[model samples]
Target: MNQDFQEAVRDTPGGTAEGQVAVVTGGANGLGEVIVRRLHSGGCRVAVADLDGHAATALAEELDGTRATARGYAADVSIRAALEQLLADVLADFHGVHILVNNAARTQAKPLLEITPDELDAVMAVNFNGMFNACQIFGAYLAEHGYGRIVNMASLAGQNGGTATGGHYASSKGAIISATKVFARELAPRGVTVNAVSPGPQDSPMVRSIVGEENLESYRRTIPVGRLGNPAFIAEMVALLASPDAASVTGACWDANGGLYMR
Candidate 1:
């Protein structure tokens, strides 16, 4: 880590996130982008880690020269070696990590019978195993530091056996929910809180790609709220879960589904 950067992070208003560092995977676009924006606005220096480094860098530049500094790193969350390097780089740049948002995921919807082993494995690797890897690596750092926040992005599909995303995607998200509980249990005593945000269908690029433009209107009508959720709405939920106000919240799954799934 650069000594100057470390000093900057240490001197951050609140220490943990006032200017402290946060890592957001899949932060180039869609819900990830919204989350990054919200965290930046909250005065956190953010590392936008994504497979698409170009887009991530662009977003960083957009937020540069502000109270919150942003950096872009290209990484494939599914690969352990890549994640190891990503974490090391983040620590080197910021001196220490305070927050981690495991938001990288892929939703490949297909009938259960039609899904191949490779397909299932790929989804599991990114959505579930990727989160596991992050928690293991960063969770250790958080425990050492004695404070941290982790918000895993899950989906309504995980809870309801999936209305939109079927098979592999749903299973992977279910695993995310389970992992959140396990992580919270293990890290709570260290002042690290782990939680999950399971969002319903949102107006995101992924949603548009999955639902299609022709069916978007019909899908919106099906939700009780009469509209697909916006990225900002989901971002608000994430912000709250990641904030000190939610200190008592851990090992919990929050449903931001516009009443689509009530539990």
Candidate 2:
């Protein structure tokens, strides 16, 4: 609920990678916002980019306070050119990017048979296409730098194919899992690690939007942990993956599903 609580629970005490610069897409809200805040608590300069320009600017200002290490940008990740410009702006502000969190995604809760062609396209454009663009563009930057960390946000639906997620959303996340592997394999040689975090129904607006408040009680009963996932917990995993200590961990999909879908 508060930044202080999130910061206190962090496993990395003095911060994961102090002085490092990170770029987080969809960083204005939900898990993305928590991730941005967690990273900042770890002493990393961050850039928060989101389609909601107002919210993004507000978040940036909240973090900026006295120091201006964190800045927000209004950009749609689905657009290739816009993402390119976002990378440029972040670079200009931070001077360099050492970590990238591909957290921007869109999803809906339509039945498999009810999903329209346009619906599939729209979800893919953000969930898959947007992630791809960021990886390729920022992946290039990380490669050139010969050192960087990339953490892609994935979901339980990607592995299970249902879990209340529509077919389009599930498929897009599955593709992201595969893409993470591809990026890891290609970028590892260049000293960049690409990993993904697949979390089960989180206690975030995104999950509430899809699952609805009325059904949350039933959903909780199904989770082995007896509760929905926490955004901060997910953020902690991202921080660990982004940290220098995780340099050897790549091409991996870390699960944070509360034993709901264990491998």
Candidate 3:
């Protein structure tokens, strides 16, 4: 970690997340990386889990002795076996899991007519099934321990039929939102709060790939905020939901879309 960044994190106050153990999937890059850093600065023990083991481990090393406790794990969120192992490892290493951020997702930009079966399935597997696997495995741990906070990453695309990635991506995210509601209801009795964060077009790696340069300017113009969303904004929202302050908030979809999709 940069000494300057570490110092800044240590000095910051107001939203202290001390003693919380959080698992952020897809934490190796882009928005996920930003979220991991923010959670760390807020004084939480963070586990940066991603499919890329090297990246995950590298991030962990970077924050090894910073203000917040940190570690990394490589696991495929889409696979049940891998997710099971990940939950076990996280529980064993951290002693308990307090928060789970289901941020791992994939998008397809193909038109409906040209969408292939395999491609569609791949998107669903990563966006929807991956969330289920994490929720089921991690939720179990939280339930056993009697407390947890779960934040599922949905998208404005899911709410508005997808502006860039097409129907397949939208469908998967919609499923995530529905799943969030279901999990919140089922887990509430166990002292677990489950919610979804639906962000509009952001300048993340995932959005950049789906929203090409030619259309990026036009898309920004269409948003009521007249600018692209920031990863920090989304990270802050996730941190809030994961905090004990949001204990009463459950089964709600927090929209961070910059007025792109109002409901």
Candidate 4:
């Protein structure tokens, strides 16, 4: 190991992402919000895209009052045209793009059998269809540029069939895990890496609501780590995968489930 490089990382964490531009979907709140903050703090120019434009702008301005390093956009990824427009908008604003983070998703707690067709379609539109379109649109731009990084958000539910989040949500995530590999293999030759970060029971609002505040202790005890995962740490993992040093990590699904589900 290079002790000199280690010291430099300690002194300036953002050096790895310096000069890189990243677009994060669903970046207005929850896990997406934390990931945006982490990347921005690491010196990456971040474009915060979400359905909620107001919140996204607030976060961007909060990070950089002059809008030099960050900006927010309102986008619905389910629409292919919208994703294409998002690509154009980002390129116009940033002059170039390098990293994309797919963190936008919808979670429902309905029972497996009770999940209706309409409900499943709604979830898939946002989680699966949206992600698939992004991979195609952005992946193309990245391939044309000959370099890019895509980090998709997966869930432990996808691997274990889930206990609280609905079956549709699990299925969508499982699809994402598979898509990551497909995109990874195709983009590898083009100098682009597509990967995923699968998280389980986190200290996030979604998990809190699913497990209930009163039963939080019991939920913590069930996990092997005896605690919920930290969103900041998850963001760090996303940032790592987005960094230049992670070129060799394509097609990998880095798990952060606190030992809840392991390979």
Off by over 4 Å in 4: 1-15
* Candidate-wise lDDT, in order: 0.85, 0.87, 0.84, 0.89
Ranked candidates (lDDT, high to low): 4, 2, 1, 3
* Highest-TM-score candidate: 4
- Least lDDT summed over 10 consecutive residues: which range in candidate 2? 1-10
Clashing pairs in 4: none
Model 1, 25-92: lDDT tens digits are: 99999889999999888888899999898998899988994523788899899998899999999878
Error of 1 at 186 (Å): 0.6
Cα lDDT for residue 228, candidate 2: 90
lDDT by residue for model 4 (47-70), tens: 999999899999999999999899
Q: Which residue pairs overlap in candidate 2's backbone? A: none
Q: In order, how many clashes per candidate? A: 1, 0, 0, 0
User: In candidate 4, how many clashes are counted?
Assistant: 0
lDDT of 2 by residue, 1-263 (tens): 13432332244543366677888999999888999999998888888999997898899889986546788899899899999999899878777788899999887778888999999889999999999999999999878867889999998899988737788989999999999999999999988999999998888777787778999899899899899988899999999999878979999999999897888
Clashing pairs for model 3 are none
Supply candidate 4's per-residue lDDT for 158: 89
User: With candidate 4 superimposed using the best TM-score fit, by how many Å does residue 112's alpha carbon deviate from the native?
Assistant: 1.2
TM-score to true structure, per model:
0.90, 0.91, 0.90, 0.94
